[model samples]
Target: MSTTDVLVVGAGPAGLACAATVLEHSDLSVVVLDAGHGPGGQYWRQPAPASGPGALDGAELADLHHDRGTFVELVRRVEQGRAEGRLEIRSEQHVWSVVPDGERYAAHTVDRSGGPGREAGSTTRARAVLVATGAYDRALPFPGWDLPGVMTVGGLQALLKAGGVRAGQRVAIGGTGPFLLPVAAGLARRGSTIVGVYEANRPGGWLREGRAVVRNPAKLGEGAGYAATMLRHRVPVRTGRMIVSAHGTDRVEAVTVARLDRAGHPVPGSEQRVAVDAVGVGWGFTPQLDLAVTLGVDLTTDLAGTPVVGVDDLQRTSRPRVYAAGEVCGVGGAALAVAEGRLAAAGIVADLSAHGMPGASVARDRREVARLRAFADAILRAHPVPAGWADRLEDDTILCRCEEVRCATVRSAIDELGATDARQVKQLTRTGMGWCQGRVCGYAAALLSSGRPGPAVERLISAPVPLGALAAQPTSEPHVE
Candidate 1:
């Protein structure tokens, strides 16, 4: 197995920033592992490589991304580090587990570079580990949500940003949060006929968070740009409305939109049917903490009741030699993620080297993180998941699509089977025992049984691994740095 001084577990904004910082500030050798085919993670997803036909170049893809200058600079710095032989980035490498190996850690990975049937397993040992696994879309269940052509807003944006492919000719977007605006604007720019943008929360809620808005003027400018795009495309945004059901024989053809009352319930006789070929919905995001959980790092909940890795001002976790940044710490935006990543690298440099990070620099980054995170908290408070979302689910609504578990089954598990939490419900009704291993349905299951999101169930294996790859793993001890 190979060894390095620092191993970063993502290649997104946070991971790229961390690796670049470590190389610039200290003599530490850094290695980055990511599951994506290239860098930028989900926020700055890139197009296919230029080697392929019809591939979009950097100039062509820049319009699809926000803060392109920052991404470009980070990528250039990372490339320079790679050229200098101080950093190595292994793309398409899925790090499934990280276990303690003496004073260091061993990260097991399944390489998907060769695609199907050629998967290989490998291990890397490092003295320090940083996890920047990022977050995934938070989806809520509605009637016909499982139907084809219905997906999360993030998935829709991924298609447009990664390949410039519009998902459908006519689309209906629904959710709570400002995220809906950008997705709708992007799709509309790509020639999709946006039927309507349904937002469950009113924009006036932002008036209450005046201090946060003043602290982050760039956010207001960004919001205004998206508003201009929507106005240019004539995309109608309806406030205090939600899509309660999608209807179709085979795929999504139409959606039933309902006005929400103050209690977040559907207003009687206020439903309208909107025709659309596709529907995109999102509540918010859930921090991806699988790797952090496996590392046994201290955990805490965020404003949305989602579990996040606990970290100090310098981004050091409770576990020694382990650090966490970006969405794994909390669901802040990319700017906050970059700041946290640089801070984590600074912490690593101070711990590994004789001279520590400059007091002024560290304090500056800490203040930046606090400002951006405050804006994030304001966003969460403004666009919270509707209190009565589960009240809209029908008895036949599927909770876990992989296991075919329905709403009625979950209720039965809670009422008749003495299941008080998501864990017990998983055991009694098999709600979270499907192929996804609770990634998709865990939130809904937890909220159904308990009033809040529950702790994630840790697994030895984070992702599905080929049996042959597992069989081929080396039994020898990893070389410690």
Candidate 2:
């Protein structure tokens, strides 16, 4: 068994910042566990060491616009911290369960390798737990989305950033938020033929956002950079437009685009069929709260109406000694995440100390967090998921890809099965029972099932746990720390 002062459940920007700050502020042993092989999570992801930054024309969006450094140097800071023996990092470990032990917590994880790879994952005990599990691309079912060439915005960017592979010869980036801009720029840099960037929200919507551009010149400059890249590549950015459907025999061959009304419904006779080899679609982001939700952390919603972990000023959750940062708190940008991480670390010190640290630069961190959150709130207000989008889904459209459950099937569960809730639909139609464990279809499945959008269902085990691991454990429940 391994032990530490804190067990951080992710290695993203927020997690890394928390670890670094804790190391600097206190004399505590820290263990950072991640499913990834390296640091940087998804936002600051780096190419494999063998590839060494790959062919990316520029650094990540964070370093490009805000940090102002090469990606290599940014990753080097954390790599160097690990080398100095300040913290322990166990990569490729997918945490599935965390149980409260006497005055500490015990976390169990699998190797993330499929098949019977459970091999009794090693246990780590810590006095405090910090969950910064990050977020995932929000996916809504549409006709032909199950086709081979349709991908998420983050998935396409990962392909380019981590493997240096252009997702397709020509691709259309369709989404409702600013993230689509960077994804399009990355694709253009990788030599993909520029087609069209379809945005469901219009510029008039952004005009209502206050100070996100004026307060942050770096953000404005970044937007300008992406605009210049699009101009150079001769790519047209279509506003107030959305991809209603994808068409192909084997893979994505073309996308059917349409201009939406102010209410986000497709305008009649305004549809156009655009030719493209692949389509990258994203509505926005969903916080990955499987681990925290299972642990009973309090839940709240963000400005975008997606659920997030509610945290105190110091990032403390309702559960004692369990802190949450980054997108798990809300889907803010990386800069906000880094600030919250550092603030959460300070909270840890004050709570753990015999005397609460006072006049200790707490007010400054709070102000910064507030400023960043305001900017983030503006971004969310500017781009929102179109209303009645679920109505556009074809009856035959598969909402649950893992189980192949269709929209009609979900409605059938409600009508025929007399199901009034998501859990009933899951039992009736297997909407969220596949290998993904409902990460992909949890929100959609619940919404279609109950006519209300909600958070992912809680499970003691976030990932698959082995029977042997279960058999060896004691029958008595461990004391809550």
Candidate 3:
């Protein structure tokens, strides 16, 4: 069986930081597995490999100055680690299932190369596993969210950051929180003629977060930079506003934006129709904890009422051999994720260093991680998914885009069918049973039906695998190379 001392899942800030630190301090071999073809996770998604470190234009630099140095250093660290033979990065390999066997972990992976067939199936055994799968954008369903050219604000940033793709020629960026500011600035940098920037939170809401900003001057500077970029580009940022509906024939051509009340419902006679080629919208992020959940790790509720990986001071999960960091731990940004990754690496190194290896001390790292986590918590408080935003969704609006299930069906299932939870609603109307396997529709369904976040549906595999691949594998033996 192919074995390693540590296995880091994910290639973003957290995973990169974890793998890099472990290789730097210890003599253990580590394998870094990620589904993506490239590194940097989502925050500093690198440009094409050919472009390397010389591809940043003036606008790109302005939009990404917050962690440009971190991104560059991470890339260089990965390059050096691979050269030293202490780190092996298996990119384009999707880790579907990670299970505990004896005293170690068996991570079943499928390489999405050479046709993504049964031939690429294998498992890696590791003494400890670190999950830093990061997060995805969470957008509540609106009247016309299903339309083409309607995407999350993060989607816009991903396109631009990863491949220099613009959001659209003329786009209206509307959402809550500081994330929207970055997306708008990124799209503007990519030459997208932004229609407007809409935020649902009350103006001057960050005054409540004054202490956090005071403590973290870097974070305050980043926010000011984004604001300056938008101002220089003549972008008007409207507060307490949201996109009600995106209108178009085949693609979004315009959006109906409305000033939201304190409850996040549309204000009477306060709607404006802006012509645009696309609409970018999102409220916040949901931690990608499918792997942690599948591994039976304990979950904690975040400020947004979503289940995140429960971790202690050292980023150790309920499961002893499994540690978690980054957004999977919680939707903190790149800096916090990097800090948590380093902390988790320290815990892993200390726990696994019984065989003539030196133990690691995390005292200094713990203090830094705590400070960064506090800033992240303050950011979460500053930009909550406004209460009652779902109340604005029309009864006829489609809730599950995969199944075309409408809001009325979910409401009826909850009110008329005596449904008390999301699973019951899902069974009654098939609200979350679709191609996405409830990843997209689960939160909306739960919020509309029940008050709290729904229970995690036990999933055996985090991602889809070919049926032939599993069927052809030996049931008793580890297929390791």
Task: Assess every candidate by TM-score.
Answer: 0.97, 0.90, 0.93
What's the best-to-worst order under TM-score?
Answer: 1, 3, 2
Best by lDDT: 1
Best by TM-score: 1
Q: Residue-wise lDDT of candidate 3 within 86-157, one digit each (tens)?
A: 788977778998888777889888777455453366788899999999988887898888888999888888
lDDT for 478 (candidate 3): 45
lDDT of predicted model 2: 0.79
TM-score of 3: 0.93
In candidate 2, position 379 carries an lDDT of: 82
RMSD of 2: 3.3
Better of 2 and 3 by lDDT: 3
Give residue 160's error in model 2 in angstroms.
1.2
- TM-score, candidate 1, is 0.97
Model 2 weakest lDDT span, ten residues long: 57-66
RMSD of each: 1.8, 3.3, 3.3
Q: Which stretches of candidate 2 lie over 4 Å from their true place?
A: 48-84, 112-120, 354-360, 415-421, 449-452, 466-481
**Error at 202, model 2, angstroms:** 1.0
lDDT tens digits by residue: candidate 1, 65-138: 89988898898988998999988899889999998888889999999898899999999999999999999998
Ranking by lDDT: 1, 3, 2
